[model samples]
Target: MMTERSIREAKAGDKAFILWDSQIKGLGAKIFPGGEKSFVLSYRVNGAKRLSTIARVSELSLKAARERAGQELVRIRSGETDPLERRREAREAPTVNDLWDRFLTEYAPERITLGRMTTGTLKDYRNQAHRYLLPVLGRMKVRDVRRTDIERMARIMAHVPVQRNRTLAFASRLFTVAEHWSLRANYTNPCRGVVRAREEPRDRILSDSELAALGKTLTSLADRYPVPVNVIRFASVTGFRIMEAAGIQWSNINFERGCVTLPQTKVGRQVRALPPAALELLKSMPRINDCDFVFTTTGKVSVAYKHLDEVFKMVCQKARIENVRMHDLRRTVATTAAGQGVGLTVLRDLLGHKTVQMAVRYARQADSAVAAAVEQTGGNIASAMGVKPKAKIVHIRKRRHG
Candidate 1:
């Protein structure tokens, strides 16, 4: 019912009115310079107000906008109003990487170590996002992302179950940042409904023969790179993370107390008691005049990032071990402690695990001792049952073939 003449006459004050454009049929231009464009129809939606534009003016004609508005109004009158909710839903969604950056800037710097763990986590997020999420939704507005896209990415990661699950978990936490930063208004995470891949089992315990070979290889490497060799050896004995071991300062050790104080770890600050073997190893290392670190690469408490990878790779190759990693040394320490009948609570404190489940992993690794008992019994079930075990053997095996 709105015509160009009536529209002009109806514009009494600063209020906006629609003018029909002859270039396009059913096209009504909003005369207001800064206001939402909506279709002018015969009746209002729910008799409340005129239905707004179905799409942007750049994309939809006035005719198309009018058609969409009419359809929406028909639904509105039926008490089925979901278009606004749908628009809100799309705008509330955001990707995991979006929230991760917020967490990194707001929380991580103040609370966590800036060494390998933090850097490694950021690196992992970048790699995973680039590999999967970025490809699909990088250019999409964070608030406009859809749950279907997230679910599809999860399905694609099924080929790598462990990494997939980890990636999803990371996404879940990253998206959780929206609640804090107000990047998105919604409280729900998009990954909340997505199915995660199954956790893959890894029985990565090293056997006795493997340990002997590794010891020999480490001894040989001592001639070439004594510092890193000692570092690896110390890590194996103490169960400290490589970065923590590398960052160990003289101030952290107490020869008299027979314990090392770690002011901070991956989870938080903790104290670890040095066993006799580890204590002796610390004593054997040469002390420097001004250096504070127990292991110094360039006269500092922290090791140089570049040299660590080379040293670790060379030692693994020499030991004929494939896939043996620096973190496994922490596992070795936990396994050894568990074999000594250390309780899960004590082990959790020693390793600075925030959760008991992490300590349980070490217990599971120590469970290989059952196999050792079976071997000693010569496969005799009754012999295994009656005899008291003489000694706990935690064998660390090296792979013979690289």
Candidate 2:
């Protein structure tokens, strides 16, 4: 039993001794050898027993201490709150790294992307964190992150505008994932207001002359470096994105159907229609060492990124082409197809674009082919309507669209 008078006269021992109160099951006075005394509350919360120090005996009378203990015990019995968890959280808020770790290990793999992210998305996220985000803001508490931090990161990597924007996007997502994980106290996504640099869409299309020169160069390289030439020619003719070209396996090619079924694309699985020229090109490629991939330099493995880039650069130099990228060849095909009066929907499907809006850019290039198509469409419409040859609609005029 512990009273105000008895607590004062209590002698300190070699170690701490807990003096339990007879009236209260959980109320006690902890007397230490150092002459310190404190009130404690013992109770079970949600099936777990808890022994929590309420206050120093000097701060409150024994009566008050007992009442406080009673209140805490009552609250725990009624299932109101758990102070232990709240205390733990306040003491140990997760850092950005902690949240990212869970994202890599648990969340990313379990998440249902429905075919948006690449197979390498997890690896890419880790690489992004290691290369950029982690170095600048890894140690900061997730709850304390602000929009200014993301914007500051953008300015830091302004030299690499693309990577800067990408980092901002990825960091903003950290908060989104953290909210569900309860990693941070704050719910606001910090990347909302970070201004991204204006980036010019790389829509560079190869001209006919440039294409002819490239074809000649590729033909010359065909004997010496056959694989690189075939890869370039296949991509140029089929309008496949660089990876879509590089990652193609013989299994993906359906000779009977005259199309390649890509199991994993940027958006999802897609089937690209191959023209007669492209089919003939695929037919001409030689198989190597039982490797499934159609575009491998080594019989056992795919061509290295550096090796592919080096050879492509050499081919471009031989063609006397300046600043033309591998992806530009794809744009050239889209533009040429559009100019030849290929409909927007057809073009979208052909390029594996997610929406027709993405294909609208090609509409701006109204070349002679499109102009000729407009004349043909108008004349056909006039004939279908039973209009005379001299009708006012027979003359083809410039319109907003083909």
Candidate 3:
């Protein structure tokens, strides 16, 4: 039997021992030789005995300790696993930080090597993880993360909607992979129902006058920065991504076939047709000795993407063109081709798009082609009506109005 007076008068002996409570089967007060006291529960599970410290005796009254021990015993009898063991497992569980390391080193690289992801996309994932995801969720146990945690992260990054959406996507992928890795349970992804931020698709393209201005600027810069200038020119004519243009090796080019084959790209392997103008431009390039790249800052490596972008910015400034990006050059090529009566299917192949829908955006920008078709149709109609197609307009001064 245990009472508050007995618990208080209990003295530490030469050895530590526990005084069992008469009312609670497994509840006891453990007295240590150092005079320290704690409430403990002694129980058995599957024939093996176990003792778990509930709390310090000084931390709880007799009534409170009995209530806690009784609840734990009831939970055990009702088929719950050992609470102490569950806590131990939780303490050793993998965290978001561990998942992040595996994702970056194992998952991302494997996908990249298999051509399922691009290096650029991997870079973006790294940025999103370090800048947003890790800061909030790194120390949390993978299995314990909830939808509220993910939504809170999204709210924290609400200012940059696009980046916030990207981070959310990254986190979603992380949780999904964690499930596969057994770091978390199945179907327990926290980002499942989270809403992504809205994003407006960019449709900016360089007009004919803008292209001419850009061309003039490139001509002026060609003497000093020939590699970047030619790289930009290649992008404009062939609609290659800037990195694709920069990474072109001489071995990838087939002048006889008039094409360049890229072994790997954002979408995978692609072969782009090289027009006569593009082929001529390639011939005029000065090849460095022992260099395989078509454009190079040094003989060993190709011109970097950063260098190309910086030069493009300078050229745009010199040309006085605003709101034009390097990627818009690729769009300009697609639009120009569309204006020349190129069909959607052909445009898809020209732009190396997997589907015609991706090329349809450029079709809407073919205003010149539309105008030309309308003019030709009207001229044929007039000719069929016995009216001269080229009637000159003679404007006479309007009679003075009284």
Cα lDDT for residue 169, candidate 3:
85
Query: What residue pairs clash in candidate 2, if any at all?
Result: none
lDDT of each: 0.68, 0.81, 0.89
- TM-score, ranked from best to worst: 3, 2, 1
User: What ranking emerges by lDDT with the best candidate at the front?
Assistant: 3, 2, 1
Top TM-score model: 3
What pairs collide in candidate 1? Answer: 206-397, 207-397, 210-397, 210-398, 211-396
Worst 10 residues of 3 by lDDT: 393-402
Candidate 2 C-alpha lDDT tens digits along 71-159:
87787778767556656775688788887888877777665365656755555677779988888788888887888887766777888
Flag regions of model 2 displaced more than 4 Å: 1-87, 90-92, 111-114, 120-124, 185-187, 366-402
Candidate 2, run of 10 with poorest lDDT: 393-402
Q: What is the lDDT of residue 256 in candidate 2?
A: 97
Error of 3 at 46 (Å): 6.7
Candidate 1: tens digits of C-alpha lDDT, residues 292-331: 8877756655665446668877877877888777777777
Candidate 1's C-alpha runs over 4 A off are 1-102, 113-136, 286-289, 304-306, 380-402
**TM-score, per-candidate, Cα-based:** 0.68, 0.69, 0.80
